[model samples]
Every structure is written in C-alpha cells, then in structure tokens.
Target chain A: MAGPKYVLEVENVHRIYESAAGYTHAIRGVTLRVPRGEFLCIMGPSGSGKSTLMNILGGLDRPTAGVYKLEGVSTSELDDDELAELRARRLGFVFQRYNLLPRATVLRNVMMPLIYTNVPVAERELRAYKALRVVGLPEEYYDHRSNELSGGQMQRVAIARALVNDPALILADEPTGALDSATSELVMELFAKLSEQGKTIVVITHDPDTSSWGDRTVHIRDGRLFTEEEERALIEAAMRSGADINARRGHT
Target chain B: MRPGDLAQETWSALSANKGRSALTILGIVIGIGAVITMTSIIGGISNSMAGMFGANAARVLTINLHGISNFTLDDVAELAKNIPDVEYTMPKAQIQHEATYEKTKVQATIHGEVNKVFEAHGYKLLQGSGFTEEDEKRGSREIILDQYSVRNLFGNTDAAVVGKSLKIGNDEYMIIGVADKVNTFSMTQYDSQSIEGIVPITTAITRLTGNPNITSIEAMTSATSDADAVAAQTKEYLSRRYKLQDSKEEGATRTVSVESNKQLMQQVTSMTSSFQAIMVTVSGISLLVGGIGIMNMMLTNVTERIREIGLRKALGAKRFDITSQFILESICLCLTGGFIGVVLGLLGSFALCGIVGAGLAAAVTGSADPVLPVIDPGAILNAVLTCVITGLIFGWYPARRAAKLDPVESLNHQ
Candidate 1:
C-alpha cells in the first residue's frame, strides 16, 4: 500500500490440499496488499507457502478461506469462469521454468492470452510483436521455438507473454531461479523497467539478491507474513550467508 | 476461445499421434462397415424374396382335397356365390400321360384348366389362343402345348405346330396353342424328353390320364378382402360342403382341413423380420466395440497430457473449454471412422451383389448379370447417428475427468 492506489488486497487467506493420504494445510493465515506500480517480492524458504499464495494471487487456484480482492472486486465471490476471465484480462503469470509451450514459437507463446479474447485475428500478432519488442527479444526469436532459447531468453519470452495481454498486475514465481546471476540480473532489470511503466509486479523467490531488486520485500515464514523488523533481520541474515551478491553483480 | 481456433488446436493435438488415431478410426470403420454390409445384403435378399413370394402367395388361397370329402364342383360354385369376399374360384387337376407326334414319343403332364387359369395364374400365352368359356363347357378337344412340349414333340414352337395333331394315350387331339414363360411352367421340372401341356378340363380326363378328380381349388380374394376373413369363410364353406357337423357331444373330427397360402406367407414374413432385428442388434454390438476403442484411446490421451491440461487451465481455459476440446477430438475421430466404414460397406455390398447375382443367374437362367444392392437410407442414417452417439457417450467421461483436473497439480505434472 505504498503507491498511489492499491491494486491487490488479501485478508487472512488460507489454502488446504485434501487427498486420500491426508489433508495438507499448505497455507495458514496470510494477509497482504500491493499498490499500483509497486514491485513486491515475496520471499520464503521451500514449503513456506509462498507458492500457494502466488497460485491464489494468480487466480490459478482459489483460497480455502478469507478475501482476495483484485482492484476492489472480491475475487472469492466470482465463479471459476469469471476468475479465468479475470486472469485472462487483468492478470499475467510467469513461472520459474519459463513455462513456454515447448513446440510453440516465441510470438505464439506471447499470443496465448489473446486467444481467450474477442480481439480480431489481425490484431493479435501486432500486440504480441509489440510485447516481444518491449522485452528486447530479437525479431529472429519470434519464430523460433520458445523452449530452444537460452535460459535468460526463455525467461524473456515468458515476460513478453505476461505483458502481451497488457495486464495491470504480473505474478512471476521465481523468474530467475534457473538462470546464472548475470542472466538473472538482466531479467530482474526487465521487471524493474516494466514496473517503471506502471505495471504492478509480485516476484516470489528464496534469493535475497532477487528480493533486493524489488521496491520492498515481504517475507513469509511458516505460512504467515513476517513483521517489518523480522523481514529486515531475515534479509540481513540471508545477505550475510550469501555476502556481496548485489556488489558482485555490479548492481547499485 | 474462438471456435475455429479451438477446433484447429483439437485437430492438431489428435493428428500429433497419427498412428494411434488412425487405428482408433479403423476400429470404427470396421464396426460401421460390418453394419452397412449386413443391412445392404439383408435388404437386397429380403426384397427379392418378398417380390417372389409376396406377390402371388398373399392373394391366392389354394385348398387341396382328399378324395373322401364330399366337396365337389357344386361346392366350388357355392363358395363363390355365398362368400361375400370370394372373388372367384378355379378348379385344377393334373395327370401324367404318354403322347406321340408322328415319330416322336414323350411323357407329358397335362394340366386341365379353365380359361381363367391363364389370367388367374401367371401363365403367358406365348403363341396361340387360350380356351374360351364355351370351349371349357363343351369339352372341346383343343390342346395347348407349352414351349417345352413343342420343343420336345415338334422340335420347335412353330406356328404350324398349333394346328398339328398329337396322340395322347391313343386319343388324337389337335394342338390349338403354344404357351410358355409362365411361373407355373417355368417352375415345373422336365427331363429332356419330357414335356407338359394344358387342355380344357372336360376333355383332359378322357384323353389324358383318366383322372376324373380335381386335385385342388384356388380362390382369389377381393382386393379389399382381409385375407384372414376370406380364409375363414372358405374354410367354413368347405366344412359345410363336406358335411362335417359340429357334434361336440360325439367329438366328431373335421372331415377336411383348409389351408391358406396367405397365412403361410405371413409366417415367412415374420421370420424374415425377426432375422433382420437380430442382425441390427448384432451390428449395435460392433459399434459399441468401436466406441470402447475410442474411449480407451481418449483415456490414454487424458492421462498422458496431464501437464498440458494444467498448462491450458493456467492459460485461462475454463472447464468447458477443456471438455469441448477433448469431445470435439473424439467426434472427429469417430466420424472419420464412420465415413470410411460407410464407404467400405458400400463397396463391400457391391462386391457381394456381384457374387450373389452370378449364383442367382445360374439358378434362374444360366446367365450371370450383376445384381445391384438395395441401399436402405434408414440403415445408413442409423449407422451415422450411432457413430455420433458413440463419440459423445464414450468421449464424455475422459473429457469430464480432464476438465475436473486441478490446474496446480497438472501444471506440476512431468
């Protein structure tokens, strides 16, 4: 809530997975808010419920309890198709593995969201081309299979895919997890540039270096948000453990 | 999603595994093909059989007499007068006798018939005149040699043969007519030296085999007459004519039994219908098997593409989108198979028609000609509809299962 207006607000959300083996409480209670044009990093260890929160935020899943309001609309009140429409029109997602369709070209991968819209056929390629250009992907890469690109380039295509629908909010789960530091830095810089263009971004990651690139970091521990002091302590401890990461990457 | 795009993607996914999809279609093809071939052949044969038997047998009721009965020519006349639906009656008698035409000698079965026999029965007078009513009553010595008889006795069916004389059992008679190409004549079996002829009943007994008995009487029903009604009236008339009283106290049995060809024809038709019903049921099982094959393949696809399903769902695909995609693919596969089966079945029926035609030609006239298949549009429509239903029924489960899959789990699937 540090920017001009709040784009997303969650109140005490919880998620549970039930199976024949047992019921798993993947998320307990977590409350959060993201203002428009703000870069928010959600930092957590493995099994710390950050991914569950990301999934709920991306509307890939519904929360078991509490409110998820996107742009003041109570998302929990919407049906599955409405939520899907919300995701298609208002939200975009990027995954850690750069989940580009393996056999599809870069432009086609970027144009996936447009398929759900009533946009004219002739306009889809133009929009996808503009998105790819914004992500600094060369024209040659537009026709090449997205999966065949280098880790950084593939992540770039994933970013272009997220931006193609002109979504107000982008949720990226570990956007730089598989890349070397330099490539990760480049991808993070792209996210920084998109935020400058007034796109609200939420990047989920375990790396403090990645979190530091955001405007503010929100740390999750045991399925709950840490206090400001606790977040600062965790970030400082993580920095101590992997010292001089930002300096090593020549980031200010 | 755009309908066109959805279909294109669905088709692309199905065609990706070319070999498996082809095999699934082949199963449907074989099933539909079997149904088509079976129905076509059954219809063709049934039609031909109905044409042969239904045409004559349904209208003509023949009553065979046992000699102990008192039923006579007067009874035949009484039935015509008394029974409201009895259109007419013709009494028939036949006897085998030796005949000679100059140096030629032959055995001939002589049919003693009235003038109505030529028209009532399917007897075509190929060459000469049929008997007049006066000729029948006067017991004229006019004789009608069938073409086979002319060929055997006169060596040909020449116009002069009609005027020539043939001696039957030492009684000389002039042949006044030559006739053939009738159902009765054609159905008669004759050795090379044997022949058949027809004469007026009044003359036949003395000149032919000395048979004074009419073996049977045929009754033609009015066009509007219910066959069962006519048969019952005829039977009642015969029982009364033979003096069989209903003495229940003495338990007197019937003196003569009455039979109707119409009843026998009804039994035959029922039997044919039952056979066709059984064939249709069997064809249904084949299509079911084809449907099961599609279900099996679709289930495999659902299981294999769990991750793809997740990806699609995450990409904002609603459950209906997922369901329709899979169902459309199944329909495409099954309909393709059905079309192929239809083509194969038609081709197969034509081939079978060729084989059956040759066999029939040999049986009928010893010359082969191709018999065309009688295509039943109802059966084809039934088959095509079955294909669509099979697709919908079988494809539904896997598609629903796919649609219900959790996006998070599927996206994480390897």
Candidate 2:
C-alpha cells in the first residue's frame, strides 16, 4: 500500500528555553512528518525534547527556528490569533496532568473546546457525551467534577475533551504518566481504539512500556531522531511475544 | 458573550464565594443608607418650619414695631384708613400680667383691638362670642383666654368664660370667650412663652396697667400676593410719618419698619440645605470607599481565577469576552448592593421621621406627598448609575489583565 498523505510536516525546528542560568536548547533542527490516520509514538529518556516537539506540533508553543505546516498551512508565518484558530480547528491535546478545570463537571470540561467553536450548546453537549461514551465512561459520570474522579477516569475525561472537537490531529504528552500499571494499560487501550477509528494520534512518552501500545515507535536522544527502525522493530517484537504468550495460555 | 450567560456565570461565582460578595455589598448598602437618612432628616426639619409659617398666613413683610414714642392710637387708625393696600390696623397695647382664675395664677398677654380690627384681620373665635360694635361703643372690659390657658386654669370643660369675671391685679374683668390656639409670631424664638391670652384694647389698657399709650401697630393686608410690595410701600409711608431717614439707601429706614416672613423662611431653608449638603458629602465618602472595596475584591478575584481565564482562552474565548464577563460580574454586585441600600435608606428615613415626630412630608420642594423620596428621581438614579460606572472603572483593569494572560504559561502554572 502507498504511504498515506502527510497531515503534518516539520522541517529543521529548533526550540530554545530561557532560564536564570542561561538559554537551554530543547530541540535542535528536528525534522519529521506524520501521515494521516497514523498512530505514532516518540520515546526517549528525560530531557529528550520529545515533549518540546509535541508542544510545537500542537501549537501550544512556537518553535524558535524553522517551519512547520499543518494541513498545508505554514504555522511559522501565522499570527498569534491565527495560530490559536488553527489549534482550535485542527489540534487536540491530552496532557499527563489531565489539565481539566477543577471547578467544571466532566461534561463541561469536555464541552469547553466547543464553546470556542460555532457549535450549538445542545450539539456540543451531545458530541461530548458521545466522546465520553466512546472512551468507556458511563453517561452518569458526565456530571462528576474533575477532582472527584480517579487518575484513570480523569485521563479518560481529558481524552473525551480532546475528541469532542473532532480535530484532525491528537497530540498526547505522557498521557498515562500518572496512572498505575493496570490503569495505564486501560488508557493505552482507549488511545488504540481511537487510532483504529482513523485518528492521526501522536503520543510522546519516556516510558518504553507505554510506547509498546503505539503502532510505530520513533526513538529520540539529545534532541535528534536516534533510531526509528530499531524502536519500531523492538515495539513490534514485544507485541508479537505478548500475543504468543496469550495464545499459549488460551486467551482470546 | 451573551448577557444571560454572563449573568448566570456571575451569579454562580458570587454564590460560590458568598461571604466575600456579601461583605463587598455591605459597604455599598451602608454608604447609600447614610446619604438617604441624612438628607431626609434635614428635609424634614425644613418642611416643619415651612408648615409653621404657612399655617399662620404670615407674609415676609409683616414686621411688629415696638416703642413708637410719638405715634398715638389715632395716628395708627388714620394710617390704616389712608394706606392703599392696608386692610386693617389695630393699636395693640400688649401687656404681660398675672391673672387669677379659680386661684390658679397664670401669666398672660392681653392684646387690645377694636371690632373692625377683628373683622378685617382673619381672627376666628373658638368659643363664646366676639366683642360687638356695641361693646366697642361701650368700651367694655372683657377678655378672651386661649384654649391652652383655659385648659390649665379651668380644666377640660369647653364651658365659656363669657360671663365670668377674672381678677387681674386690683381690677376684675369679664371673660368673653376662649380663643383657639394663637399662632404666635415669635414662639419659635422663645420656647418658654405660652402665647396665652387676648382682650379688647380698651379693657387691656383700663384693667391692666392703665396705660393709654399704644406700644405697636399690627396690620394685615387685603391681598397676600402683593403683600411684600404693600409692606415696602407701608414702610415708605411710615418713614415719612415718623420723620426717619434711610440708613443705607438714602431713602428711609424707619423705626416702624415693615418686614416679611419670607426672609426668615429663606434663612431656615438655607440652613437646612447646608446641613443636608454636609451630610450628603460625608455619605459620598462612604460610597467612594465602598467602590474602592469593590475594586480590591475584583482584583483579588481576577488573580485567583487566572487558571479559569487560561482555560477559557484555550477554548476560544476572545479578550473582549473575558473582559465583559468580569465587568458584568462587578456591575451585578454593585447593583445588588445599591438595591438593598435604597430600600434600607427609605425605611431609615421613615423611621427617623417617626422618631422626630415631624410626620413625613414631600421629600422635594413644591409638590405634596405624591412621589416618595420627594427629591429628584435623578438623585437615586444617579446613585445607581454611579455604582454601575464605578464597577466598570474598577473592574476593567483586572479584566484586561486576565484576558491578556498566555494560555500555555497559565496552564503550566500549578
């Protein structure tokens, strides 16, 4: 099959952070491309610049240098308002912390992005419920406040919020970072199901265990792509070994 | 943002922080209450004074002349007959004497007048009969006691003293009747005097001090409208008759000067207005302080809700939308406070009137008690508008700061 059309194109992007000590280079001339409906993951140790690249791609921050295009629109050339509009229209984000408004109900949290959109209130609420339903949360949990929910529940709520807007790209930064091993597995399964529904999902994480959930893995070290082939091969092998073990145990 | 949405949001937020919102509103209530109470009290006093003057039918030009050395009773009668607008003139020989009625000695003033004086001047008798033309022809020594003195000396009976003889010093005079409450001209100046008695001019002069000379001349006019002009004209006439020269304007400043009640009324009005102004000013300070409190609270609220602002921006809210939400919240707060304040102020003013025993009058001038808070509706409207504008003034800067916050940085903040 031919490679899918590129939904996102990044060329020689650099990100610099200013601190009291001095300026720190987070991303160094990173170049990458993401195809439509591809489930991709970036994995590395701490300070790998994976999250930095995810931030730039999500329009949460502008890159210090170079250009990136989202759906043929150059992000580098857009003004702040235009960039915000682009993010609202095309990008959805899920953070490790969930970043849900503590005062808002789960349904209201999900409906937040739709508030900025031209969608009617009833339609926005319906779409939010549908997204939550897709993530396996009960309809009754819609009224539950964010702080009242468990770690896994909160992440699911965040996922529902991200999907409610029906954006083209989903950028999740360490989405399972706060969950336990079992809860992390549940969240990863939700991401996998979203990907199966033709979503272009990019997850950035430092955990190799979490990276195993993605269809393809790209490893980064010191702000550069270290070994894409080796990372994908390793993830594929781990999945195969798990399938073999489950089959031997007679599990479906 | 829609107004309905903003209102709902503001209400919800205020409810969430009930204590803070109540405290902020309390400031405004007290401020408005103070203004209303002060103005009402001052207005009440002025109204009472006006009522007193109105009841007496006193004109600004009506002045009582005392100690006219050369003017006789015949001269006073001649002037009344000659003057153009002068309705009636009476040579009043007023004397304070102790009278014994059933052994209770009461101090009284005997005012002497002829029959024509009572007819032209507007004097109403409450009980018994007034002196007739025959009594004037006979020069009868008969007295009229006021209702207050009658109650003090003869108890609550409405029985007439018309035939009873009352001893005054060595001479005894027959009591003709009881007069109604005398509208004393200078009672406001002297609270101790009772304004208690009246008798015919001949009786007062003959039965009391036996002084044939009249002390003062009391005159009333035919028309109330041109009473002041009549007074000025009378003063000119008196200045020529008394051979007095004008002290200031090269005309005549007569010893028998004619004055109007309008000057006294104006003085009372100005005094009341200044008092009201001072009180309103003090209340204004309170309102100013209350506005400051609102501003301080709104600022704190903005700082506390920075994360919520960031979330709103990320969700697609524009800067104006965020600013509008907060400014609306502030106005709503102040309006709530102002409403309570007006109600409390009105109640407070009523309570003050009750306490002072000066029944409620029109809060404004000219009209009677129709519109409550009798002053300008503009005063209350201006107060409400002031609060609303204050909210906008105080709430704008904080709202702008909130709208300008970077979503990424704010979200990253713990």
| Candidate number achieving the greatest TM-score relative to the actual structure | 1
Backbone clashes for every candidate come to 0, 13
Index of the highest-DockQ prediction: 1
After superposing the true interface residues, what Cα RMSD does each candidate give? 1.4, 2.5
Candidate 2 on B265-381: residue-level lDDT in tens? 667778878888888888888888888888889889988887677666655576777888888888888888888887788788777666544233323332222222334355578
TM for candidate 2 is 0.72
Docking class of 1: medium
- What are the chain A TM-scores of the candidates, in order? 0.88, 0.87
- Per-prediction TM-score, please? 0.78, 0.72
Model 2 fnat value: 0.31
lDDT of 1 by residue, B13-33 (tens): 886888999998877898888
Alpha-carbon shift of residue A147 in model 1 (angstroms):
6.9
Per-residue lDDT of model 2, residues A1-252, tens digit only? 233388888889889999999998888887888888888888987887887787788876788998888877888888766777777678888888888878678988898777666677789788998999989898888898888999999999999988988888888989989989999999999899999999989999999888888888878766766456754555566587875422332221
DockQ of 1: 0.50
Q: What is the lDDT of candidate 1?
A: 0.79
